[model samples]
Target chain A: MPSIECREIYFSYRRSDPVLKGVSLSASPGEMLGIVGPNGAGKSTLIRIMAGLLKPQNGSVLLEGLMLHGLASDDRARRIAYVPQDYHLVFPFTVMDVVLSGRYAHGALKIFETREDRVIAGRVLKWTGLENLADRKFEDLSGGERQRAVLAAALAQEPELMLLDEPTSSLDVNHADNLMALLDRLCSDQGLTVIMAVHDLSLASAWCNRLGFLDQGRMNALGEPARVLSFDRLKSVYGDSVKRLDLDGRIVIAPRGKRNTNA
Target chain B: MLDMDKTRRKLVLACILGGLWLLACGLSGLLIGSTSIDIVRALNGSGPDAQILLVARLPRVLLAALTGGALASAGVGFQALLRNPLATPFTLGVSSGASLGAASAILLGLDTALLGSAAVPLFALAGAGLAVAVVYMLARRRGSLLSTNTLLLAGVCLAFFFGAVMLFLHYLADFGNSYRMIRWLMGSLDITDIMVPLKVFVLTIIGFILLYSNSRRLNVMSAGEEVAQSRGIDVDKVQRRIYFSGSLLTASVVAATGPIGFVGLVVPHVVRMFTGPDHRVLLPASFFAGAGFLILCDLLARVLIAPTEIPVGVITAILGGPFLVWLLRRQVEN
Candidate 1:
């Protein structure tokens, strides 16, 4: 199966200027592709469209070689899972309760969870290293735990394609790297295809197999990390005050250090 | 596994207990009254007890139980839709539209027309439908519905607009007619027509089943729209279903009972405290609890200051308002 593929997509909000313009990309299972962009670059918008949350104004999305438009939402959900930046629940649902909600498409008409659903939820929670906190209210968890809980929830969908929008924006460095590592492991071990919009360039470079630099509603660059984050493209897209360093075959892009007082 | 098992257990227990509670309240409504009827004679159909029980009390009680069940279910649905615990069945302007219809009908002297009693309910139902249509039109962006905030704002604004129209009508009416209008606005379940309860029974069954089946979808929505969609939910379709189903349910009950307040607002909260907000359990638990709560409230309306019966709406407000505060305090303390 080809997983999720977007073809020359275009989208705008309420007749405003287009947020995304003629973008085309395809991701396959066993790959982690990161879309890196500045604020207002439409990374989240693209991710949302791919997750089937928003309709692209032009062009099309295909899932597993079938048109995304024709696939029923329930069936699409069985194949794809999306993790947003934030998950806010007003009701005090427990961790297990939230995780089990991911199993919804398994039995469309089943109101209560079957034994199999429970078993899957339990396994996902453990896989996410959250078994001890399964009984706690989701709101009670720390920021990192909640993020993992959300990831665990998506994994419970048993999806072949996972789309995440700004998945680590609010996370601290330690938790952010941990979360990315988990995605990397899942892609290799379970053959899951991950498409994520990431703000931090170096982080995206570190984990993703392929990186797409999106700027001003357009895809400016798409390739391996070293090629995409070239010195010239980095200065042009991000402006001055940035540096790219290559150490031990790893590419790390960081802000210029100890610049003159006003330069 | 433990948490999942506990939720399943809670669902089963709530259904069994709630069914029993609904039955008990229904029987209490039939048996206990301000003018006590001799059950033996009433069942045998041989005395004035039969006339009093069948004609006056049975219909009122049946209407109360069904309306209570319906309002509470709608309340749960709205709270989930809005993702706010404070949302009520009337939070979206349906009840206000119904009130405006009843008030305008009274001003037009439909109260004294041929088949007058049926006029108010029919007008109220129409008004509720029209109001929902207006709110939907305003809340809809392009073709999709409810950005949630837009729906809530549009609904609140429509309620205010309809309420002003109702008040203006109330001001134009004569003193006696105005009194009738206000009494209807306060919501009462004094119908003598058994058919009203029968209609409510049918609507409640359909609405509850339609809503109950969407419990899984509602749970996914609790995690927000993005997460909900990735889980294979059509957010727009689900939102439309809840809005219409809840509006239809609340509309039917308001047409029959004059917009009984608080039962729809507080009963879900009370049940949520027990069932912990799983719609599968919260819905059924709230229905039974609300039905029982209203039956007792209505019973007290009859007997609390006997011979000068309080409005059932008044009873629910007085009890529900304080009970909600108490529940909030308990939750905070815990």
Candidate 2:
């Protein structure tokens, strides 16, 4: 069975306007699913629904044939972990403190972290290459490092499925590539499922086994990267003023040219 | 292993220092009062000195400690839940509502003997509860308490509304009633009975436990709401639990002590500077430091003018104001 199955989900922030409409998708074990979409196409909203952060007004999310929303929050968290696109730290929490919080569900009711919890947090920090910065304050980290810290925190959950919203948004190119490669390795080696909302089509195409294109809160395309990243599909969603080229058997998209209307 | 040991050692040292400081402050609070009783005589339980120490000073000191601890604990929870460092127990209009209730009772000439001296406090508690209920209802959206901004705005507006009502009551009162109202508003720890403090002490302990139990969730929550929920926290439940417990804590303290200012606002920040942002350590440490801090402030208020006591609230503001400004400046520079 699919690890997580979202069926015909519909959500609206307000009564008159909808943010997601009849969105259905599934993620299986040992696969990486990438969601690519334009701005405000409900990528973040969809991920939030799957993680059960936001309740969809209609439809349901199922995990292993069980209702996702019906499970206790701790139970759900044990199976699936989510990483948000942006985090704003108001207090000066250390990186170790941030990572240790992920084991909260596993800890006893009184909220003290155990020695085992520390071990998991430390291991995840090393895996994310954040052990050296564990003592630094979260607010002091660079954007790329901060992103990795948040990912490490999620990793400390030891989830079977991980959902990330624009995990590479704050990372430099080298760091972004490294993160994607790490996620790719984790999925294959650990038999984990990763569903991430990505804006970079090239990275998504390279790392993800499946790509889902979203537009106007609906799934515009869903298939292999080569099939979903077609020139016609790209033009339809992103407008005709975009160009695509094949380099090293990879698809690259860019704006067609600078407008010369002034001349 | 080395780093964990060092952190553990630092925490233990802080606890030791805080415990010693609190003990010293407690002794000074007992020894130094208006009459300047001899500490040896008071401890020996001889003559009227013993009565003054056991009957008057002991209750006052305990009350101050409980109120201070409650306010500080609530403050930490409020700052975390609201995601604003500036948030305090008073940020939600609980104090203003309590004051309005007390002022109205005084202005209307309610008999103090009627309910055995608890009339004012009961009214104040009711008013605080009502104000929080209104703010909670107004801020809730789509069945979730997800909007901290909306909650903050609602709380501020309610505070203004309650403050206006209080001013109108003040305007309507006679001169003697107005004087009593102002005195109560200034916050005093002068109480003869020990029941109120004991009851509130129990309540504060419960509140502290509720907050401490959720301390780890609060750490994740400080990152953001989405982050907290992503880590298996029932965000709405946790928010509701903390908000209710924090507000109730402030309400109970305000009912007894008449809105002691700055303890709720400054103590948590001060404690955070030493304990870092881990609420597990921050909450309990704030309780101890706050208890000691207010006892010291109350001692200062009692002895500075000796015979004529300044309001403890005034002393707290005088001490906390400059410290807050300096802290804000540092925050900006950083």
Candidate 3:
């Protein structure tokens, strides 16, 4: 059975046009699924829906053959963890504090942090290679370090499935590659299912086992990268001013010359 | 785990220190009223000192402590709920609403004609409830999403509206009632009957517990609402509880103290610098520290320029004003 499945999902903000229309997808263990799309193509919204953070106006989400929305939030969080794109980091909470916050599901009624929770958080921090920076305040970290810290916090949830929204938006090239590699390793090694909304098509194509191309609130393509990201498909969705090149057995798309001017 | 234990020890030690400081402040308040007194002789000997200490100063100190603790606790919750550090006990304009209620009650002759002195606090509480209800309704948007902007704007509008009503009432009152209303507005903890304030303080403590139970969720929320919701929190439910508790705590304290300022806005921030952002530690520690701070302020109000007392509100403002400037500048430099 699939770990998470969404059938005919539809969502819209109040009184506005639909942001998602009849979106259906599913993921199983030991796989990395990437949703790649232009800005405002309902990528983040879909991830939020899958995380059980939003109620779809229509359709349903199922996790491990059970209804997603039926379970309590803490129950859902135990199975699926979400890493948000934009963190509001208002206070100077330590990295340790940030990771320990994920243990709320483990101890909702307990006020103080327990030894078991500390051990788990420490293990996650070490796994994410952030053990050295555990004492540092969140605001004091570099961009890559902060991203890793948030990832570590989500890992503390001990989830079977992880959903990330634009996890590499704040990282440099090396950090982005490093993070994708780490996620890739985690998925295959631990039988973890990772579904991420990625803006970088090249990274998505290279790392993800399956890629879903979203355009104008609809899933245009979903399959292996070579099948889903055909040259003609890229031109049709992204317009005529793009070029696709096969570089060392990898499909790389680059913006060619000036922007498309006339209709 | 050793560090975890160390952290707990630090938190416990801090709370103990805060409790001790509050105790010291209470003792000092007894000693430093209008006239200094040696306590052992006063309690032992049949003198006016015993009456002065127990009847007059003790209740005053307790009330001051209650007011301060309640305001600071509410402030901490509101700040975390709204995710804005600038939030205070009065941020939602409940204090102005209470003030209006008290002012109108005084002017309407409710103090003498109907429920006697009890009527004023009753009316003020009603006004506070009205203000909270209106703001709560106005801020609500699209299925459980409470708009922070709307809450703030509605609060500001209510504050202005209530302030105008208060001024009109103040303008129309006769001189004797006018003096009474004015004194209540300036905030005095000097009440012969401490029963009403004590009950409100008890209610406020209950509210603090509700906030404390959600302190972990609040720690996650400080990262962002989305972050909190993603981490298994029922964001809407938690937000509603925190907002309700914060409003109740602030309203109860304002009704008792006639709108004490500075303690709400400054105390939580001051306590946070020491406690860091852990709401579990921050909540109780701020309560005690705030109590001590207000006791010190109330003592100064009494001791400075003896025989004639400065309004406690005036003392808070005079002291709080410069402290706010320093805080603002420091915030910018950081």
Candidate 4:
């Protein structure tokens, strides 16, 4: 069975309108699944539901054959770690302090971090290339560095599956590529399941083993990257003005210019 | 290793210095009340000095420390729960409610001998509890107490409403009663019997322990509610626990001593600057520092005008206001 599965999940913030409607996807261990969608397509809401932060009004999420909602919060955290899109720090906590907080689920109640907890946090920091910034204030880090710091914190949870919501939305090209490569390596080397929502279709096609395209709170397509990222599917979901090109073994989607449209 | 050692050293120094300061201030408060006492005679437990020391001064000083510590700890709890540096007992209208209760008691001429000395404090505690219940009821959305903005707005409105009621009571009271009511509203550290402070001490100690045990969870919460939940914290549960405990802590303190301001708002910020936002360290440190700070303020209130005692709350604001401004400026500069 897939390590993580969502069966016909449905959710809504209000009674009148739904944010997610009958969306179902699954991810096996040692694989990366990328979700691509336009704005307001319920990418964030879906990820939150998978992470157990939000409960779907209908259907269910299962982790390792157990109901995600049935598991206690700490138990769910032990199995799945979630990285949010933005983090706001109100006080000056060191980067180490921020990362060490990830071990909160593992520690005994009312107890502080232990020696083993420090070792794990340090390892994750080094893996994420944040060891040099350990003592620096979390608020002082750059955007890309902050994103990586948050990723490192998620890694410290030692979770079997990791859920990231638009993890690269704020990063520059180089940092974005570096983060994707790191995630790919962690998936292969550690046998971890990674499910992330990405805005960059090219990056999603290049790194993800499979892609799920969402349009208006419904799954429009789900398959291998090439099948899901087809020109006709892209044009239909995104609009008729969308076009794609295959370059360097990556599918790149772009808006059709006036000259190209006329031709 | 060196960094850890430096941190340990700093913590030890703060504890030692804070303990000594509390001791000095407590002694000074005992010795320098409205009337001077012979220290040796008072310590010997004989003479008029003994009567004043045992009956009045000692209980007042202890109450000041306990109330100060309770308010400060509750301040830290509120700030963490609301994720706002400015949150305090006053921000939640608990103190205002207590103030209204005390004023009403005084205006109505409630007999202390019949109701016991705790009549006013009990009334104040009930008012504070009612205010919190109203704020909670207003802020809750679909059975979840997750909205900090709604809570803040409701608390502020309740405060204004309670303030208007107190003013109307003052306007109706006779001149002698109005003067007494106003003085009580200004905040005092007066204690007639030792039992009140002893009871408050026990209650506040239990409150502080509960708050301390949840410090780790609070540390995670300071990041944000969603982030806290992702890390396995039950945000709603923590919010409810902290809110009720913090409000009760404030109520107990405000009930005994009329709403002593500034200590709750200022002491936590000062302690945060030194402790760097870890609640396990911050909460305890705030309690100690707050205890010392209020005792010192009480000492100043006693000595500033000699025979005519200034209100302790006035002294706390006058002293804490400029200091907080300076601290904020320094934080910005750094």
* Number of colliding residue pairs in each model: 0, 0, 0, 0
State which docking tier applies to candidate 4: medium
User: Chain B TM-score, candidate 4?
Assistant: 0.92
Task: Give the higher-DockQ candidate: 2 or 3.
Answer: 3
Ranking of predictions according to lDDT: 1, 4, 3, 2
Choose the strongest candidate by DockQ: 3
lDDT of 4 by residue, A30-54 (tens): 9999999889999999999999988
Quantify all predictions' global Cα lDDT against the true fold.
Answer: 0.88, 0.86, 0.86, 0.87
- Lowest summed lDDT over 10 consecutive residues: which window, candidate 3 chain A? A254-263
Q: Estimate each model's TM-score.
A: 0.94, 0.94, 0.96, 0.95
Summarize candidate 2's per-residue lDDT along B126-159 as a digit string, tens digits.
8888888988888888666647888899999999
Maximum-lDDT candidate: 1
For candidate 4, the lDDT comes to 0.87
- Expressed as tens digits, the lDDT of each residue in B23-64 for candidate 4 is 887888788877889989998977899988888788888999
**DockQ values for all predictions?**
0.71, 0.66, 0.74, 0.59
lDDT of 3 by residue, A179-209 (tens): 9999999998999999999988888888999
Which has the better TM-score: candidate 2, or candidate 3?
Answer: 3
Evaluate candidate 3 and give its CAPRI docking class based on DockQ: medium
The residue-by-residue lDDT of candidate 2 on A155-200, one tens digit each, is 8999998999999988877999999998988999998899999998
lDDT of 1 by residue, B119-192 (tens): 88888888898898998889988776467888999999999999888878878888988898888888888778
Off by over 4 Å in 1: A257-263, B1-5, B27-31, B36-45, B48-50, B113-116
Q: What is the DockQ of candidate 3?
A: 0.74
